[model samples]
Target: MQFYLDGYRPGDPEYRPAAPGRDESSKGAAALPDEVDVLIVGTGPAGVVLAAQLAEFPGITTRVVERRGGPLEIGQADGVACRTVEMFNAFGLAEKLVREGYWVNEATFWGPDGTRNGSTAGITRTGRVQDVADGLSEYPHVIVNQARMQEYLLEKMRTSPSRLVPEYGVEATGVEVLDDGGDYPVKVTLQREGGDTAVVRAKYVVGCDGARSAVRKSLGIELRGDARNHAWGVMDVLAVTDFPDIRLKSVVQSPAGGNLLIIPREGGYLVRFYVDLGDLDPADRDARKRFTFDSIVAAAQKALHPYTLEVKSTAWWSVYEVGQRIADRFDDVLDAERGTRTPRVFIAGDACHTHSAKAGQGMNVSMQDGFNLGWKLAAVLEGRSPESLLDTYAEERRVIAQELIDFDLRFSTMMAAHPTDPAHPELGGVDPAEKQRMFTEAGRYTAGFATEYTPGLLTRSAEHQAVATGFPVGQRFYSAPVIRLADAKPLGLGHVAQADGRWRIYAFAGAGDPTSPDSGIAQLAAFLGESEDSPVRRFTPDGADLDAVFDVRAVLQQDHRELEVEALPAFLRPVKGPFGLKDYEKVFTPDLKGGRDIFDERGIDRERGAIVVVRPDQYVAAVLPLDAHAELADFFAAFMQPAAALV
Candidate 1:
């Protein structure tokens, strides 16, 4: 496999494991056909990101499977959004996307008469202004097309010493997971390019296929969602339209027809126009199938002006509608009861939560599925987190899917709307905020940055640690800052922090710096980067966020807001002392708990005493204080990597 991922073309006269139950030898290493620590079963954003993350662990033997002709090595339209920028930075692909991509800082939405009703801040905040989307995820919110991203990921996977060689394109099919109330290894069946069947077995099998995943169905796990019979043809055309005009008109409706979108993409402006394939109307079902590109163009021309529609081919295009968010149930993963977690046959990405893109969350949310599921899988593959931790995937992600579905529901209503106008007839409802939330949320779902974890194995029996009025306390926020007050440099702490960042314990020195010499800590007082700090996300003292968690009000007493104490508890505040920004000890109280811990003793350590177990992706997995180490190993035993499975 060492030479295979070294940019090898894959097909050889003698080597062929592209069949079911087939095995191959590479780098003088011999293993079973199914022996692998982590087996990824797709190569899209989710699959590729998972492979890249697992590839970071040397002991884990990682393998990636794609059903396409390798990574899409060329740029194409579709699957692009302004919210994926953070993930790009995490995966070290930010620079490429930012340089070659467009920084859609300001997007204007106009009413019928060029009256801009809504505004979206461009993704970029200008030179060295801390890219609003940086460190948010493994990728960024730029339009680089699928091929560009795939090529970059494929190249990185190739250079990985612990190579996760992309294997067997779509030729590979069928994955069977064998589990009987205990641990059941995964068996995957693959059909080579030439009708040969190969089977590869592994400890874990991840399904990254699209919504219609065969692996998901094989597990009998029915994804509960609306499989509406609606067909929407996407146009990746090259034509300059009066997009600048839409700065005033959010929805363009003419006598001819109404086009939904007027987006200016990289190559050209992409005007999203809808065609009634009549899939939704049983009466028009037959007529819908006959709908063609010319029909798509005809409808678009009616709404758009100064445009000659020349279809420049489509990419990753599909036709589907509003789906639900509910999964089968805990019984699906375990027994009838949610007690003994037995859920196997993991399904991530679109396969798990398929929804209408009317909310502009298809690509953004799909990638988030990967971010949510990536680390736990890596931990299980690395022998660090627990198998019970795997249950969190559904617990946390299910909530996200539910929210996304709701967002889509609102968007569907908005898109089907005509501006409500009493003065003029063409106008219907003017409500755009409900509709705008989708894009903004798409821009700031803050998936990887979102820290709220629904009660699962990790948060089981977690009691809130009371903070004092003086201690530098952070409440339940996604991430806290490692403010180096010495130079006043406030380090952005996402799940994935940069160099000089392994495990940063944000303790306090007690002494508040009016103007700390250190720029690092000084910068910490600056704006908390969460999508331009809009009003929709206003953080009050009572709001559950970093301020409420860390209780930073004492430092900037006036401007800072902390939750109004029911009784002004003394425990939630920051400890006071001459906090030397220079010394880690002087600044960070060693005893201060990061709230959630993997093995922290409950009583021995104060309420604020807990350790944070951050995955390589930078997310807190199991947070416990001292004395819970046993559970840590158990957690790792079930969730972390398999010791025997690792290379």
Candidate 2:
């Protein structure tokens, strides 16, 4: 929340000054640009996230198009994962979402009770487990409408420096990658609402369009996977139920009746149900047509057994056959054997991978796909990083998408299976306890904390991992609480990271006093600030803020009150902004009052200290010794271009 850097005038500091030609009056009426640095297809979670992130970089021209006439109002995906919530914090949208969405704390499992003496068996609460494991994330798993989430992201783009607004009533018809090495190598054919069509050229194109993506089709990529014949009907309804765990996230399984997954929605009165519609016949051409909203409600009531459900209103409902599919490749690199071919067009979200919704991973992972690709695209477009950096998007995200598909297959199978059916002993039944255990163990992945990228251009080798064991290389940097040295404000170290496309270097002070010249922090700061070949000096443009390309911060072992801000190194408190005011938020200390010692919690060695390099998307790139300056320089040189080269 740093502000007033440009010598603020008065009104909302958060309000970004509009770009040169983008005024409020020209919002939707403005014609589509014939050329753009990046062109995005679809306005789903993935597309909106990419647009929101690119909007931060006003220097690059980014445009988004959707086939719909306007914003999404209802019916798509819900369930925002903990990791997605952390990402939203970077855009300053986490608090509002948490306040508006329903927080899922515990999940209860219900199974048929054999002890009941009634003609119809009753369901009994078998097990209750926490939705997210302890300390998995500071944020909670939330359930909100997908439309509301897009609206928030859209608002962020509207307020950003780029003043980005999606062009509705327009759809991408064709895509072609030109062989000529020109500025805009990708040509896109767009069809407007009427019969009119136009052509636009872009340096890069991202397909966030759903399962049936036209962009993916243009690339000649095929989704290869198996469809399990299981059918499920999902609906968001306003209902009154006698079920005890109606408000809580609950799973009900009946031997004869179908299974139901009940998730309470945001408004407290609304709840979403995924009702098992049984297996569909292979010969049936339109299985979904046979099931209506009333049939789905009846199936849900049957699954609840003794409990009853009276649906007053149906908000949204759809029937879907369980299918886990993923594209063969996520990029336009058709012939990978041809070495060193840079990808010009990419696909993300449902365009890349899709699975059942019961796992609540479709929207969560889709947003992450955009987050992973957005910063890389921005860096290359701004000439800050080489074009080769774009190659890592497909390599990394494709693996993650595959993993999600695998997990969904296992989870969906268990949910669809009957619980210990004696008559059909050949069909192995899913035990209630075993189901609960699977859910508990899969918390980390579902919460979005378990994704780890392999060593590549971005992720460095874990040679110095022992120095900082908690912040593993190639994984999202786990946040910890720390007190700001300047104002003594308590906050998470990761919260300081915004989606502004800048690298983060956290220098932990060694055993010696940080103010002493002999300490590692002081030496490292001097090297980064004075050395000619240091990453900060080589990549940062001339006359720009010293922390513009790389934000260097220090965390000392001593309390904030005991340390003097003036004694810290120049790099720790660089002067910036039009007024040249000294920035004081770079230095931090452990929160003693909160009993959070980051050094102990994250296993940072206090005697030797360590340096953590985090990517713009908040993933830890490398962990090195305090004096590993050469390795640090080489890491950035692998992708980042020198400022002089850009000039």
Candidate 3:
């Protein structure tokens, strides 16, 4: 039950290289075979991790293709967050990063000192970082170059059992889905890259090709959101400075111009700065665009105090205008106007959602998008999941993408606005109150606290759903709960569930003698009673049956709650045997977490009580909010037992 509860830390040992023969490459891109079970485009964080996850699954032919050729061979690189690193460890890339990357602990804030102000002590740090959760995770965060990571992935990928074709760029200019709805096997198309073109076929296709996603366009799906060109500078340099704040600083700033951040990496340093060329007058804008490298260096020097800052060679550098956008529908038909029919096309990374990279969440969010999707897709592909499970990927990830964009909007707005105050530049433009607010929120996001999936139904629609529900699942985060499997206890009612690892929920309430094998739920209850991962408590039949303590199912029938409850992540399993659970509430009962449900929390009472159905993923199936348990149950019965419904 404690598996992955607290993520792997510096020396926690989950980090290890792949079993060589399975991942290493065998032949050149041209020589490699063409067909596969899954073809993933783009080898960025999203693609790489996805490939890694899929490779571990048996009977799946997965491949990773990057138009840009090999890893670290090109492309500008950046840093990795704790979450990214944690994932890397899972896929066995963290150790490589740790060996080749740098560790940064703190960040600094700077502001303009004068009209041509040298610099001001705006905010002293990027923001307070999260203290490593005790026994929850090993390292809080790490700064590693993007290219280096790609290199590491390339080496590891060479041995992947999945067929990997790194340089075969997809010319998915226009593709018609041959099997639009028959489980997407053997898609036929022609591909062109490097002045070469040919026909190709694959069982599946993934669009990780980024913003100008070929798969998305081929599906004829149009992006559905706004895009803005935000100005920002990122440079990875060999700084010749003994600046004490180098390792500690996260965000650097200025008043008259944009600021710089000292990303104290192991190789050297990566500094980032924000700029706005939009409001600039024509002359200033044109002149600045054509500004020489000298001006950029000058800008850098102004922000960071130099000891002997001579420009060593630039390891990687790029200036990106930040932008934000989202797709209207997860999938669409490829008709002339908007595609005639929906294709089994899936898009991850920037293709699905794009946003300005400020808090370093772009990579993290993208990786998470892949994580939430990869396992589920594999499930569907393996025939373990209902086709409806695939739909959940879009429904869930869309909200996450929206959350990122919203955060970036607020962060970027406040970041670009220079504080009018000089004495306390860190305060931005407002008084102490606003400064405190910024710091608090910044700390929360920077610590990755704002990143967890909500416990609310874990359902797709959030409007009528509650944000938190279920027993211990999605109930608490930062550490998955520990349950005594032997005791068969409930783990998530509030004080259980952590995001670090999966959970194995059980119940000692099964029928039979507490000592009989039938009371194996008893053995499970006993084991969970001592497990150290999450809190496990036995149910009290008299007043603790949960029926008395909370009106869980009752609230549903009353339409008092609207959100669905989420099951704990599927990874959690029985410690040493097949998992088991009490029969699902043999019958929908009147018990609901008291009369206090999500809607009731808002002080809104329903005119009539109805059935509050809970879906498998823990979202409100439907809030009948009326005491019609039979009717509500019948509707769901139709959903799960279609054939039975007709009879």
In order, the Cα lDDT scores of the candidates are 0.46, 0.90, 0.47
The TM-score between candidate 1 and the true structure equals 0.64
The CA lDDT at 512 in model 1 is 36
- C-alpha RMSD of each candidate structure in angstroms: 13.3, 1.5, 11.5
Return the TM-score for each candidate structure.
Answer: 0.64, 0.98, 0.64
Residue lDDT tens for model 1, 1-647: 11232133656522323222222222212122457766777777677766666655545666776667656654433334544555555666666777876444443432333332223211111111122254343334444566676666665555454544677454337766565412336677877666767787776777777667666766667777654555555554455443444222133333223435443445444433443232466466554456667766666654443334555655333333434555553113644545465444577777777666544566666666676666666555444445666777777777767777766666555555543444574555543443344434544442323334554554432432322221111212234343322233343334234211122223211223323433222333232223233111232222222221122221121111221222121222222323311122112111112332111212213333333343333334444432343443344333333232211
Error of 2 at 453 (Å): 0.6
Instruction: Measure candidate 3: CA RMSD.
Output: 11.5
Q: What's the distance in Å from true for residue 361, model 1? A: 2.0
Show where candidate 2 strays beyond 4 Å.
26-30, 422-427, 644-647
Q: What is the lDDT of residue 574 in candidate 1?
A: 25
Model 2 alpha-carbon miss at residue 203, Å? 1.0
Per-residue accuracy of model 3 over 338-435 as CA lDDT, tens digit each: 42333356788887877776566777767766666676556555543344555556666777788788887777666555446656666746332343
Question: Lowest summed-lDDT stretch of 10 residues in model 1?
Answer: 120-129
Q: Any idea what lDDT model 2 has?
A: 0.90
Q: Give the distance in Å from residue 255's predicted Cα in candidate 1 to where it truly belongs.
A: 5.9
